[model samples]
Target: MPTEPATYPGYRFPAAVIHHAIWLYHLFSLSLRDIELILAERGVVVSHESIRRWCLRFGTEFAAKLRKRRPRPGDTWHMDEVYLKINGELFYLWRAVDQHGVVLYILVQERRNATAAKRFFKRLLVGLKYKPRKIITDGLRSYGVAQREVLPGVRPRTSRYLNNRAENSHKPTRRRERQMQRFKSPEHAQWFLSAHAMIYGHFRPRRHLMTAGQYRRSRDQALRIWRQETCARVVE
Candidate 1:
């Protein structure tokens, strides 16, 4: 196992509680206040502000560690974009996922035009180590333009119903958005959602496709990986 960073030193609480709070915030539809209440009932009283600070500081760190441990992206990609409202204005959240629903990248932008599509493509290519063999997307003309420019050789398929994998991945974000009563700002949305995606992908196995025994095994493995990556000494 790769050594995680040194334990966080500034916190008064143990690493386990701190990590648990962060995990609950991202892994479920719990708001900061909701988490604070849950912890309060459990006899661990922490302010919601402290939970927010922990998420802001340590969420990215945990995401980076999990991303480092994830398997390579699958060869086929399904891409989609959804609109998110921030401060009464609409913005697009560009998301790409593989065939198995592993998220490739998510970007929040002011437009869903060709320029935005091209930027998302570039970001995915630069961040991921491998190029996709084929791409599936909705009948979005911008995807064609960006694909031709950034990945000229890959096969691109445009279909209305075939890209549901990418579209379905947005449900968690929607639920969380509702739980938190919408995002405060674009940067805030991006930071929280990106880290949320990483943590979600780690714990979420394809449960419908697995038998009970397999599901249990997969879940145990996911938890083990999370502990190893986050350097958490306690598992709840």
Candidate 2:
């Protein structure tokens, strides 16, 4: 079993219950209500709203911890934008994931224009502090401009097949969106996704490509990261 971080100062629920709810929410695509009911069967009688709060507060933190402890991303990046409908209007989610399929950055915008592209590029580069050797994107002019300004000298490749990795990455988000009906507001969408991306980044293994031993090691590493991030404590 995994241990909770000392920095948590102890939560309302046991670490096991908190961890179980989070894992179910992320791993099985279960909503807060669904997770609550699932736990109820196991003799934990937490409310759906409580589960929701747990996910909102601790999910991203756990994922951030996992990311900090994981291996660095590959030097190649894949960028793409997917349309999200909110209140019958269209919005865009610009995401950048590295060669190893680790999500490096994500931004929710009302448009997919040059300004939006520039903003996304800037956000993506802010924490990286290093340039990628190659960037893959579809034939979007905004991407071209942003790449020129933000990541100049790096090869920006646009082609049908090359950008498939980025396009495929949107599937999980799409599934979750469909399950939830639709995002109520941009803020809600951003908040949920920002947390969701980090959680998704943590437990997802390279199952199709890696061997059993490699996958097991990856899983263990992810768990270790979660423990360290959530358990960090400073002595008084």
Candidate 3:
């Protein structure tokens, strides 16, 4: 079998290297400068700004491919909204994860009212193209209102404890927030987290349910698909 070479036009670095840098940024709470230093130890001399540019260029493209390749998510979705402070302004980060803890989607909005909730619901329905069987959320009145208007048929369960999965999923975002000293803007936060959530979830399977060998194999398969999506020959 012949493996076609990846042509990352107008870039001198190989596609694998670029994708690896992007992977390092998302898979952990590493900053651009941190990624630069890590790659420096590997004999690849590149500036942090260059890595940031690479992330901006390819992160969304790679994440979209990964999202499309993912299996159908669980029917029971857990949704949550948390406040984010970007530039000292309040922004609401709306997130949804399935019962299996796979991130379904994320949105950054300026409000957390019924209108905002409906918007998130609509966006979710567009991506899923179907209604989830049930949704669990915190005791937010907006969720109840949104469910009635947007998803009239789906049952909604209000529980702060049962929605812990969605809350726990925000931990990674928190870590990244601290690592980056907070996002510069709402757009930047959404753009970065959009890719980060999908890619991060892809590599982090439920290791507790898997044997050591199964965990390793799962991670390896994730890497393989990540490479293909980035049009790279291998994971560097």
lDDT values for all models: 0.90, 0.81, 0.91
Tens digits of per-residue lDDT for model 3, 104-159: 88999999999999999988888666778999999899999999999999999999
- Clashes by residue pair, model 1: none
Count of clashing residue pairs in every prediction: 0, 3, 0
lDDT of 1 by residue, 112-200 (tens): 99999999999887766578899999998999999999999999999989999999999999998998889999999899889999998
208, model 2: CA deviation in Å?
A: 2.0
Model 1 lDDT-worst window of ten: 1-10
Model 3, residue pairs in steric clash = none
> Candidate 1: misplaced stretches above 4 Å?
1-7, 232-236
- Quick one: ranking by lDDT, best first? 3, 1, 2
Judge candidate 3 against the unseen true structure and give its global Cα lDDT, from 0 to 1.
Answer: 0.91
Name the best candidate (by lDDT).
3
How far in Å is the alpha carbon of 39 misplaced in model 1? 1.7
Sorted by TM-score (best first), the order is 3, 1, 2
Q: Evaluated with TM-score, which candidate comes out highest?
A: 3
